[model samples]
Target: MSESDSPDDIGTSPDSLDLSPREPSARQRRQRRPWLAMIVLLLVVAAGGVVLTKFLTSAIDYYCNVDEIGAKEGCEAGRRLRIQGIVDVGSVTDNATATEFSMSFGGVSLPVVYEGEPGGIFKECIPVVVHGILRDGVFNGDRIEVKHSNEYEAENPDRIVGETDKGSECSQ
Candidate 1:
């Protein structure tokens, strides 16, 4: 209650007053501004690398025809494939464990063994795409995509076998 002590100076002390602004720590710097952008960019690059690896490893599958099995570059054994061929008449045999069949194209037959039943218009004398890997001489297939009547006629309307076309390397 002294007269020299004003209301403003009553509660203030020199030891307690610190008005200088201090630099932020390294942790604080990482949580704001350019560091944030760098962090985001790093994450984006990591994700892109993962996607590219997945695409190169499995997504880029090889497609070929029945006659191109051993001759094609990507149609070798121990790799994934999409082989297209016509289902030979009376070659489909569905036992309890699998469906075994032979597909013919370029007058060559490729034996396929699928582990499951195919759906959506699959039958004899039709073109199909078999997805799987070739082990030895047999194709260990997992899926069958029948190029049904409508799709076949629409896509290959003029695919005629004539004297000029490669006459059956398979046929003697």
Candidate 2:
């Protein structure tokens, strides 16, 4: 094809000859790239937000002694934490709805009101772990787990009989 060739020599339809405004293929792809990237980025960000929300919303299991309720960090009121203590002698009171009890640890007493009846040897002078939130000076417990795994009791099997006979010396 030389410059001398006329436009009539080349085949051209009436529609092709018309100067209609239409984007090129490369321009279309380029225009679509930003929207594609934005969708992918938005998906990634949304997935990240979901993961962060699950991590933040999940219950944090931080076990603390009853004495550390106000003394230790992350062991204050309004936060969910696990408190372990020996149930005070003659402290448990169970009604139709809930159970109220006081436990002692390191000379500090924490009064707890469990929403349900505790099972598995939940008795006076027994070490128990309660999971709940501390609100308005009292622990609002929803679950109770008696700490039955004691190293001393495990090692001194013979002393268990005498100890049970004498009962716990965990004074209030």
Candidate 3:
């Protein structure tokens, strides 16, 4: 044992002693930050997926003509849809509880059982749009829109109908 060596410095040499405070390197800083960043990124992605699914579901618009629906297999049971057709004359039967009718298009007929009142202009041979679902081969309708053609005009000089307040025009 050397006389100059003390018991307090038994195994450590002067070259091996590190007494300064350590500063973290760039790699260590990066490692500590990723866990928080990853959690935040995952939450953002999940929220985006939910919003996208909701938008797509609400934006869906499914509609078809009576003939097309009858001829194709795309209309699944219990799926809501819109059907465009001409109301058959004498086919409407309005009861105390419901209105049952038949519509025709391209020789295809669709039986509709509506639980609501038909529109004011609804009648034989009128173009209509029915909103409903097909159950047991019949349309269970909730709403009906009657489409009227513009046949009455304001400019016919020969007007053969009842007189209006014309204010001037009935003669050429």
Candidate 4:
């Protein structure tokens, strides 16, 4: 066989068949890994921020009997809440504009300023749930719920004798 035509190839070696070069070096791969980790961390932080915002924005409304509002702790002012009590009959003072009124709760006798129209159940001697926030040593109510015991008698057959009858009577 001629030297140039030899089957034991010369230029056609396995090393010459490598077309794809410039494969990423270990250093380059290591550098890219940090960026990938940073991206994952950023995504996690963003997700946590969203969850925290939702939790903070979720209004926490709670019911407190008359005595709780006048406690030493003062019912944690600035949080939305409902204070249940008897509407102080004569204690309700209608503002000159008639759009606002002030009522008092029994026991603590804390004065609550209410804005907006009062409901039909807003009468005196009724169990009331005032919705608002306790701020500056007073209850600023935006909505009021007057719950009567008789209203629940038909719905709850096993009604107690004095379940809704609890609370103070307004002092005229």
Most accurate candidate by lDDT: 2
TM-score of each: 0.52, 0.54, 0.50, 0.45
Candidate 2 per-residue C-alpha lDDT over 1-172 given as tens digits, one digit per residue, 9 for 90 to 100: 4455567855554343445765569878788798889999999999999988877754454368988877888777688888999998778899999999999898899999998889898988889999999888899998898887544524565553455454446532
In the order shown, the candidates' Cα RMSDs to the true structure are 9.3, 9.2, 12.8, 10.5
The TM-score that candidate 2 achieves is 0.54
Per-residue C-alpha lDDT of model 1 across residues 45-70, encoded as one tens digit per residue: 99999999989965675368988877
Runs of candidate 3 exceeding 4 Å displacement = 1-62, 70-77, 153-172
Ranking by TM-score: 2, 1, 3, 4
Name the candidate that leads on TM-score: 2
Q: What local lDDT score does residue 104 receive in model 4, on the 0 to 100 scale?
A: 49
Give Cα distance to truth, residue 144, candidate 1, Å. 0.8
- Separately for all candidates shown, the number of backbone clashes (residues 3 or more apart, or on different chains) is 0, 0, 0, 0
Q: What is the TM-score (0 to 1) of candidate 4?
A: 0.45
- 1-172: candidate 3 lDDT, tens digit per residue: 4456677766676733445656889998888998899999999999999988977864354457888884556545567888878888678899998999898887788999999789769877778889889999899999998877777657888866554432222121
Model 4 CA lDDT for position 150: 48
Off by over 4 Å in 4: 1-62, 70-75, 96-106, 151-172
TM-score: which is higher, 2 or 3?
2
lDDT of every predicted structure (CA atoms): 0.79, 0.81, 0.77, 0.66
